[model samples]
Target chain A: MPLLDLRGVTKDYKLGKTVVHALRGLDLRIEKGEIVAIMGPSGSGKSTLMHILGCLDVPTSGEASIEESQISSLSEKQLVELRGHKIGFVFQTFNLMQTLSAQQNVELPMIFQGMKKKERAQRATELLTMVGLADRVNHRPNELSGGERQRVAIARALANDPEILFADEPTGNLDSESGGTILELLKRLSTEYGKTVIIVTHDPDAAAIAERIIHLHDGRVVEEVKNA
Target chain B: MLKDFFMLAARSITHRRMRSWLTVIGVFIGITAVVALISVGLGLNKTVEQQVAGVFGVDTFVLVPKGSFGPQRHAGGSSDQYALDLEFLKSIPGVKVAAAVRQRTGFVQGPTKADGTSTQGFLPVMGLSTELVNEFESFTGKLTVQPGGRLFLPEDKDVAVLGADTAERLEAKVGDTLLIAGDANKELNLTVVGIMAPNDEEASTGSSGGFSAGMQPAQSKDTIYVPYDTMSLLWGEASDVLVTLVRTQPGADVDEVADRVEKELNARGSEVSSITYSDISDAIGTMTTTVSAFLAGIAGIALLVGAVGVMNTMFTSVLERTKEIGVMKAVGARNSHILTIFLIESGLMGFVGGVVGTLAGLGLSALASMFIGRFFGVQMAVVASPALILITLAGSFLLGAFAGLWPAWRASKLPVVDALRYE
Candidate 1:
């Protein structure tokens, strides 16, 4: 069975007297150890699809399964657990808390998991070391390079050792050198760690690193290609 | 969890250092006012009660010739025929000591006076038994003869012992001659026997300048004491009104004795009127309560206003941290966490305010007490009762919690996504 499955998913928003169809009749399947990049322009409903799959929002109709557990049928509490324990998220803006140091930011998700402080600290240190940010652990987000901040956000996403990693515009806020370094880390995270990684991006250069690429326009998949 | 909460609270307060300090000051004034004013009031009430109790010690009841409704009301129309006779005093059971006091108001004539060194007007002269002097001294336990001799002896009919200032005014000393004169056939050529030491209230007020200098004038300076027998002999039936004083046995219920004395005096004749020690004390208590209520009402209003200030601050905090609230909620914090954090913050503000206010109050009360002791001839101190302090702290805590309620609720009910989107 696929690690994740979505069948005829639809999301609708009511804006006063009008209705906005954010996602309509979408079907997708993702297997373990696959690196897929979802490429789209703005207003193509890709973000809505990503939000639904992350369990941050539910689809208006249809079914979603993560690790064979039907996520759309779960309660709000169960949805939280699914998001907390199984899926990790990275945002384009490098959503690192400004007040916290890089190491503290990484340890935040583990805090939600009720891990002991000593254990959480040990793991957070290890992950920052893995992301080439061992020396920047004590530095706040503003004190770090753009690539370094995104690395901290990635470390935060991995704090629970999630089964699937989701990156939204993973290299959008970086120069070529930093952006290339982040894409290399993503490739390593999928290939070496054997984790399923999905990235949503508009840059073809960034998408070229993915094992498989799905092109989307106007809320529908337009083309698919395999990376050489 | 507790540590985390405390650290968060301390850090947050420190982050807004100026605001925190200003809040602390506001709360401090409120706390101090409550503690100091109430305490001083308590202390003054205690001192007044103590003075009154000392002035008329245990087991003693006073009798006025004409009946009056309250102790404050002085009786009218002195009747010479209805005076308390010595025989009637000796007849009452359980009355170990008794005296009938006859007061006459007069002034001392200056001898060879200089200009501006006028004859001082004296406090009313109460002619009583030699035993009455002993009773007063024993009750107060501090009265001493400061200069040149003892009180008048019963047989020494033409002698008088002047108060300290009265002796200076009349220019008389022990064995020095003075004409003790009053109106309507009351006059005596008496020798000054002794000058008593100044009382506590008198000594404090004398150096503090008279009434014009925000100080009460000394009541002791113009007082004189002479034997009841001596006054009667000198005046020759001119002094007729009697103020009788009686004391019951130790451990005996005073009210019972008072009732018994009243019954006995009434049985002898309706002309004898008695006032128990309880009556004057009760009247004094009522007056103190009324005064305290008036004063505390103003302080309470100040505290209420402080609470309003706290509410305003909390409302501003809620508006300022709206985005933070959303982030916390999105991070999986429940509504209870949001509520608790804000409540704890407000309560902490109150607690700090309470501490500072308590200190401020103490300082204010001390100043007040000094002024009272200096001028009013009444000793007042800033009282620090544990109950009062606790009440003050609790009041601030309640005010903090009460003020934070709406803000906390507003924070808790914020939609997570909208809050995250708020600037």
Candidate 2:
């Protein structure tokens, strides 16, 4: 069975008196240890799809399963547990807590997962070291460079040893050199560590690193590219 | 979870240190006033009780004439100004010593010697039996003659004791002769045999009330102490004389004795008014308690104002921590957890305020007691006790908790999404 499955998924929103359909009867499947790139222009429902995949937003209709457990029907608390224990997200803005050190930020997910402080710190250090941010453990977000901040975000995404890592335009806020480094890191996550990595990006260069790419236009998948 | 709540609380306080201090101060002032007022009131209550016990002595049934509510306005009222008769005193059973006292005014000459500096001062003359001396001594110990001789004995009917001021004014000593006169111009020669000290300078100068050996402005300077029989003989049965002082055995209830005395006196052909020590003490007690409560209630107004200040500070704190509240909620903090944290923070502020206010009140009361007592000649002591302090602290914390309720509820109800999006 696929790690993440979606069948006939539909998401609708009410903006005042007007109705906007964010997702319209979408069907998709992603297996374990697979690196997939979702490419779409702005307002193509790609962000909404990412939100559903990451368990941050619920679908209005349809079934989504993560690890064969029905994700769409889970309670909010259950969803939080699923998010904390099974999924990690990397936002484009590097949404790190400003008041917390980089190390504390990385350990946040494990803390939510109810790990002991010592164990959480141990895991956080290893992940930070993996992302080449070991020396910046104590630095707050304000003290870090853009690339370093994204790296910290990447380390945080792996804090609880999640089965899937979701990166939403992870290099969108970085310079070309920093962006290249982040793409390399994501590629390494899928190729070397065997994490189910999903990247949503508009940049063709960023998408090139993925083994499979799905192109979306106007809230629907238009084509698929395989780079075997 | 508790740890997280504690850390959140600590951070909340640190981030808004000034508002926290302001809230604390508000609660502190309220607690201090409540405690200080209660303590001082208790002290005054204790003092008055002690004074009444001392003044009334063991068991005494005093007969005072009742005042009239009539049109006439007089010091003793228009109650048929009659004194206790000597016949009734000699008749009553279980009655030990019945001394009839006759009050009159006279003057003393300030040492008219061979050099001649004749200064005349007025004094009050209390003419009574030798037995009545015991009653006078018990009421005001200064009523005793300190030196140069003794009080009037039954045999020494023509001898008198001089108050210190009376003696100083007249420059008279033992064996000195002074002429004693009455309201009816009845005059007699008396020898000054003893001198007594005044209760205090203020009491001596007639500036305050309470018993004093010195002559008051209303009394005679040429004060005389003669035997009751001598006065009876000098001015026969026509002059009214029924007021008598009666002393009971120790531990006897003075109220019962006074009631019995009143019945006996009324049965013997004369109206009676019995003045028990309990009457005066009760009056003073009621008056003191009323005044203390009134002043305390007024002080409570200031405390209410302080509570308002605390409420305002708490509201500001809630507003400033909106973003933080959002973050906590997003991290899975329940609504009750958020409420408890705010309550604890507010209560802690109130508790600290209460402690500081209590200390401030104690210091102020002590300073006032020391300085004001010396200047005003009234004894004022601030009595701070542990029970009172604890009550004040608890009361302040309650006030703080009450103040935080609305703010805390508002904070906890804020939507997590909106709060996270807050600036």
Candidate 3:
């Protein structure tokens, strides 16, 4: 079964008396363990698609499902549980809680999962070590470099061990060297763990890491490119 | 989950130390005022009860004129011509001894050394029987005879007992002679047989009420007490009964006897009233409660203002952390979790405020007591028990939680998508 599927999904944004169509009947599917990138310029509805696929939002029409559970059919509480346990996201800004240390940030999703301290601690420590931030576990986001902070966010994203991970402009705030390292981490995550990875960005270098790139325009999939 | 939320709340509060402490200050000031006033009120209540109980014995029934409270009032011709006949009072059921205490302004002169003419100091003189004086020493007003002196027997003539201050002013030791002259200079030489030891616990309040206080200040200190026979001689001013003390038999129903005494005195055309120690104590208790409640009400107003201050701070905190709230929701925090975290934060603020206020209030009460003792010569006691502190802490915490409810609810209801996008 596909890891993520969106059929005839439409999302609309209302501004005063105007209804802004953010997405228009977008049909998409990604197989399990695949790396896909959705690329588009501003106002191309790529951001809205990212939100729907990440479970942070639902489509106004049509079915968006993760692991066979329909997003639009879930209650608020069910939605909360589904996203908390099955979906993970990385942002362009790192979005690490400034007050939390590296380890605490990683443990946050597991906390919502109702995992005990000892269990989540062990997993969080292992994830941080995997991201090469074991020594920086006690440092807050402000104390870490851009690359290190992003590494912590990646570790946090994997804390729940979701089947798929979504990156929204993941390397937008980092220098090229740091950005390359983050891309390397995402590649390692999918290749070794057999997890599906999706990247939403306008960065060609970022899309280059994906097996396939889906280009969106005016809320529709306009072109597709396969990476060799 | 609760533990996690509490830790989160703690971290958030500690992050903005100055603002949290300022919010706590608002709550603590109200708590301090309330605690200090309660402490002082309790102490004053203790002192007043002890004084009233000492002067009016539980087993004794006392009578003053109708419409008057103290025994020393309305002394002209003695309770409307019936004169509180001691023999008649002793005839009542359950009566052990009944005696009338007569107080009059007397001219007192220290030993004149054979004819050396000394100035006279007008002081109040009270007369009671020797047996009644002995009973009074044990039950009423904590009166005691100092050493090197003795109470006068019925056969003993021209003998008197001096209160502590009276003895000091007269400079008369036991056995020294003083001339006590009544109205029209009708004088007699009296030997000081005994001196009363000072009553230290209640020096000023209850002791002054029933000793012809209206005619002259009824002080336990400067009053001279003589036998009933000596007072009857004017000394000789027509047997005016100031007050009557009626002691009931041991274990007898004193209230019943008190009712009978009042009825007998009033039934034969004498206007008299009976009073017990409980009545006086209850009256003082009511006055203290009213005053304490009034002052506490003002403090409660300040506390209400403090609660509003807490709400204001929480609202600001929720607004400032809007983006943080978004991030938290993105990480899988449920609305309930967010709500609980904010509530805990505000409740912790209030609890801390209560704790600090209780300590500061105790300190303030102690300082106040010291000043009152030094400047006003009144020893003000303070009572701050552990239970009171605990109650205050809990109350303040609840106030904080209640104040934070709306803000916390707003924080919890923020949209996850918009919150993540919030700056």
Candidate 4:
């Protein structure tokens, strides 16, 4: 069975007097340990699709499921639990809490999961080390380099040991060298760590690291290709 | 879990140090006003009550004619024809002792000026019954004579005990003879027996200024005391009883005895009012409550403004941290978690204000006590009861939480995606 499946997924948003369609009857599937890059323009519903799959949002009128549990059938509480334990997100701005140290930011998700302090602290250190930020554990976001901040965000994303990792425009805010390093880390996470990595980006270099690339336009997928 | 939430709240508060303290000032001002004003008012009331209690003994009751002034009712009458029935007063079950007081203004000539000099103008000369010759000191509890002098003895005639200030004015010493020129130009000599010491309680009560200041009808420090029969010898059966004094047995409830005495006195077909120790204290208490209520009105208004300030601050916080809220939601924080965190933050602001305000209030009350003591010569025992402090702290916290409820709910209800995208 596919690790994640979507069928006829649609979402609509209302702004003032007009109804805006963000997604339209999109069908897709993702298997375990696969690195897939979803390439799309600004209005191509990339965010809406990523939100549904990450459990941050639910589909408007279709079935979106992880394994056997349908996203539409889950309660608000269950949806939050699913999001918390099953998926992790890395944003373009590297949303590491500005007030927290790198290690503390990584421990945040585990804190909400009610993990013990000493245990989560040890794991946060290990996650930071895995993201190649072992020496910058105590540095705050303002003190860290752009690359280091993105690594901290990735460390935080993996804090709860989630099954799927979503990187939204992960390289958009980084210089080429730092961007190359982040894409390399994503490839390594999928290859060695067995995480099903999903990259939502308009960057060709970000798509180059993925095993499959899906193209989207105007709220629907248009083309698919395998990376060389 | 709650600790973690509190830590999170503390982080947010510390992040915006200036705004948080500005919000806290709004609350602490009101708490400070309430705490200081109420404490000072209560302290003044307590201080005056203590002074008045020391001035007048609680175990004794003084009964006077309703319309009498300065304990002098008439110019001439025997005990039997007097306004009050001394025998019936002495017959009361709780009445351990009774004394009939007679007082009037009279002229007396000192030893050097006797034959040709007219005399000093009329001053208050009070006479006490034989029962008071020794028992008056014990019954009154606060009155005492100088160390070298003695009270007038029952068997002794034509002797006087000069009040503290009156002795200074008269330049009369113990063993000095004063010739009294009576109603019909009759001459009498009285030896100075005892010179009364200054009443410290009366001195304090007399000098202080407050609403209840001078509430205790202060006895003149210039009065002269003599035996009841000697008064008749001086006045020739003309002086009438002005005030009646009754001392109740120790361990008897003074209020109960006072009520009984009041009942008996009222039954005499007169409109006289009998005062008890509780009456004086209650008068002070009423004044304190009135002052406190007026202050509480100001505090109520201040706290209302403080509440609005807290609500406003919380709403602004929700707006300012919109993205932070989104990040927290994305990280697995439920809406209840967000709500609780914001509530705790606001509640903590109020609680801190209460703490600081209580300290400030205590400091202000200390200054007020010093001012009253120095300027008014009134000793004030300022007290901030632990109960008041605790209640104030708890009340401020609850008020903060109540004020923050709507804002926290609004924060928690914000759409996670939009909040993440908020600038």
DockQ for each model: 0.18, 0.12, 0.48, 0.53
True-contact fraction for model 2? 0.00
Badly placed stretches (over 4 Å) of model 2 are A1-228, B16-141, B144-324, B342-401
Global lDDT of model 1? 0.71
TM-score of every candidate relative to the true structure: 0.70, 0.64, 0.79, 0.81
**Residue by residue across B1-423, what tens digits does model 1's lDDT show?**
444444445545666678767776666666676677677778877776666676567787766655553653455664532455565666677777776656566554433345545354544565657766566443323345665588656577767767777777677667766666676766676677777675566555433321111111134556676678765654554235445667777777777777777777667664666666677668777887777777777777777777676777778877877776754554444566677767777777888898888877877888888988799766775677888788888888877778778888888878655565467
The digit string of per-residue lDDT tens for model 1 on A1-228 reads: 999888888878887999888777777888898998988788777777777777767778888788777877787667667766777887787777665789878876676566788999999999999999999999988999999999998888888898888888989999989999888998898999988999999988788888889876766667788898
> How big is the positional error of residue B285 in model 1, measured in Å on the Cα after superposition?
7.2
lDDT of 3 by residue, A1-228 (tens): 777899999999898999999899999999888899999989999878988887888999999998798988988788788678777888898888777899999998888778899999999999999999989999999999999999999999889998778998988999999999999999988899987899999888899999999999999999989999
lDDT of the candidates, in the order given = 0.71, 0.71, 0.82, 0.80
> What global local distance difference test value does model 2 have?
0.71
Model 1 chain B worst lDDT run, 10 consecutive residues: B208-217
For each of the candidates, what fraction of the native contacts does it recover?
Answer: 0.02, 0.00, 0.46, 0.44
lDDT of 4 at B220: 50
Go through the candidates in order and give the clash count of each.
Answer: 8, 19, 2, 2
Using TM-score as the yardstick, the better of models 1 and 3 is 3
Rank by TM-score, highest first.
4, 3, 1, 2
